[model samples]
Target: MKLTVCSSVLLLLLTFSFCHGGNIFVFPAEGSHWINMDILLQALHSRGHNITILRSTRSWYIKANASYYNALSMPVEKSIDETFITNLMKAGVQFVLGTTPWLSSINILTKMVDIITYLHSAVCELVSAVLDDAALMKTLEDTKFDLVLSDPCWGGGVILAKYMKLPLVYYVRWQIGEDAHFGIAPSPLSYIPVTGSGFTDRMTFLQRVKNMILYLVTYIQNDVISGRLYQPTCAKYLGPDCDFNQIKTDADIWLMRTDFVFDYPRPTMPNVVYIGGFQCKPAKPLPEHLEEFVQSSGEHGVVIMPMGTFVSELPDDMANGIAAALAKLPQKVIWRYKGKRPASVGNNTLVVDWMPQNDLLGHPKIKLFVAHGGTNGVHEAIYHGVPVAGLPMYFDQYDNLLRLQERGGAKIVSISTVDKDDSFLEAMQEVLTDPSYRENMQRLSRLHRDQPVEPMDKALFWIEFVMRHKGAAHLKAQSYNMSWFTYHSVDVVLFLTAAVLLVLLTSFMFIRCLFRALCKRKVKRE
Candidate 1:
């Protein structure tokens, strides 16, 4: 009877703790960004947090039906639909492949910037929809959310967090125009490379110059173009003087979706937490068909290639060339592509719309990952200790692959060169035969998994920390709010420089007067 009473008391306490879990308002971007954000929401759900996800009516990936979280499906005029994204992907691929005319480079750059501005306009439209709706605003206010957990890629979350007067935590890997670090941390151009620059941390003179130029472009686009799109909303809803960039930096915690293990060593902020491979888990049982395919390989293993979600198909020739190369290999292949079936596809090659990427990577029979070098794929490869033959197309793909290449874990081949002279096969054969690649990746896996606490746990702790304390203001540095002049100590440098010049001038004047007076005295005496 005494032991039964003690058990009941313990159970009650556990239930009470779970019942008090924090309420989180989630605003996420579309496509793979949603994929990453959904994983975090799952973690939050398991911990009993009340999660509310806001999605537009046009989102195909993010549906309103889910058990773990409540949804606010708002009607919008337009969402960044897949057709829009796929066209952008194809255009980017053609540019990277150099198929576009040389003179079109400037046009492509301008169009890309315009596309980004237009997308931000869509986001601002959504933000305006939410803020302008009296019923929705009232409903959100009644919810009394503990904090806003947002993907900082979109400005809507930041604005809403302030509008609701809630503590904001960013689940982020990027801001509008550059890596998130450049926004919140100290990024020295000498070492820290800009995103899409395709230059590593250690750069040549020309590389550093290019990084600076890209930095300027990114800064102007982010501060001017992107900022202007959102600033009007900020003025109307947030405040007339409230700066958009300032609103972005005002986030309480930045749960950065990267780690030094997969990223370059760079300066970081205290409030910016790294949870690189938090989405990864041990291999689960494969489906019967996939299992049979793997078992058929016998001594040979399987190679799975996925080109990420936004890119559903490749050009026919490119797809056929890749398929032809994979067919000749002894290893069985499973490729996630929704494109036309390659004419050269062999019986050994299985073309599927999708496969369980994390599970497949963790399987022992998996040999090499032919990847497009997205952050999710790279981190998953690291988690599963799989080397990659990288075919980087656009965006940060090349840079992500470069990190693995620098560490001797992956090999990258250009899309332009992928089909030329059996380049795809050669790259695949090299990583497959080279034990060093797998060894290097395995070593990285150990380092990544050797953290004191699981990355998810750390992420959870900080998110809850903000909720319990109302905000993580104490962890945020004052330097984040300072201007460039004060943050870099330009004022102090100018003051010291002026003071030193004043002293030298004073000394020279006194010496000249003394010399002239002494000469006059000597003349008078003579």
Candidate 2:
């Protein structure tokens, strides 16, 4: 009877906790955001958790594109200080955030905050800004988060998690980090400076040294600058016990928003979870106009031209060039141009500021993606097994385009020098005619689709697992402690050298002994 009563009490407590356990707060990258996050939000909601979204106005594309010129320039720490705490308080969350800093590089110049400042300059700025905020510390004290989800780029996410006494889980929308490259040999392709294009796998002796030195320099710089900002916040709210270095070292969990197929022949970390295409949901019925457009575009297929959110001001020359090129093609073009359509466009060319991008990508009739090669766009193209022609403008786009070209699934045309007319037309013609591109894409798609679980589920499962297990320390890699020579294990080389030396010594001794014996025999015989 006593045992039964205790068991009943335990069950009741668990039930109560499940019913009222804190909600999940998602702080996404600004201006209402990318496509995959929606899937994550929906998944959380479906799992019976309450969800709140906090996003900044500055986006990933702000620096490169003029549209975000006004928004990006505003200090992020000021913006974050103004909004994040108030929103979290209002939502009554236990705490959760995706990545950190809407613009990390932009915040670096202000010296107001310290942010994780990833590979990009904007990331540095954002990290600097967040570290500077006073209110954020108070908020962390007031409502302690159980976990914080961060974009892999926002190295500061882990920092914030430590400050809040929460577990840090990196959320990647792309490939896994270098530590995770066990199964996949790093490809020789050097796309984005270090992270993109599998460069981690092919890093040479000198490159590794340079990378380590650079990483140490940046880490020290950020730590010192950001530590100064944290001093005030800690003095006011966290009671000086908060050590930023301790927090920096504890980032172990990573939740990737990438699918396995999209990041083929790539390395991954144990903590890294690939959840690309997580945002894909069942398609809603196309709007009447969109349906008619798709239907009218003959079976030869349609090409989607999406420049993405940041590049709103499409040049008239570029539009006219595309229009002129499309007029000569048999395929229908569904161009996503935010600006006015040029007069040169033919009747078959459909111009809209935005279309349901994923739906269009999934469309059976759509064959080509004329893209700016943003990570999201690249993922979508690969998800649907569609070939792409990248009009790369900045950042990782060059790397993404390079990866595509290497895979034989896409072609790249740099916007800096290529003429708007003949060059664009010729590239499109090549992609359309080339069967190899389509075949490679299809192969990738199949691999991506064969994953055992959906990316969101995998993410959530690991998140809950962290909560249940209090950080899977068992799964964490100790590579940070291993020296470069040790991690790669130079002992093998030493062993081979020793074996060769021993063999040579033995052969010399044997030959010398034989020669001495021959001389002795000759002397004795004589």
Query: Which regions of candidate 2 are displaced past 4 Å?
Result: 1-21, 25-27, 31-35, 52-144, 173-246, 264-267, 308-311, 417-421, 479-526
Candidate 2 TM-score to native: 0.66
- Per-candidate TM-score against the hidden true structure: 0.96, 0.66
Name the candidate that leads on lDDT.
1
- The weakest ten consecutive residues by lDDT in model 1 span 307-316
User: Tens digit of lDDT per residue, candidate 1, span 297-389?
Assistant: 888899999873533555677777888899989999998877677799889988888899999999999999999998999999999999999
Residue-wise C-alpha lDDT for candidate 2, range 1-526, written one tens digit per residue: 9999999999999887775344443434432233455556556556665544333344432232222111213355333332432332222211111123546434333322222222223434454555456675465455544566555333345444554566666655422123223212222233213443223334676766665565455445545644554444443334566554344334556665555455545555577666776665445677898888887877788888876343334456655766787777888888876667678878878888888888888888888898877777777787788999888654356666666777789888756333334787788889999999999988877776777786667878887777666677787767644444776679878888899999999999999999999999999999
Clashes of 2: 33
Q: Show the colliding residue pairs in model 1.
A: none
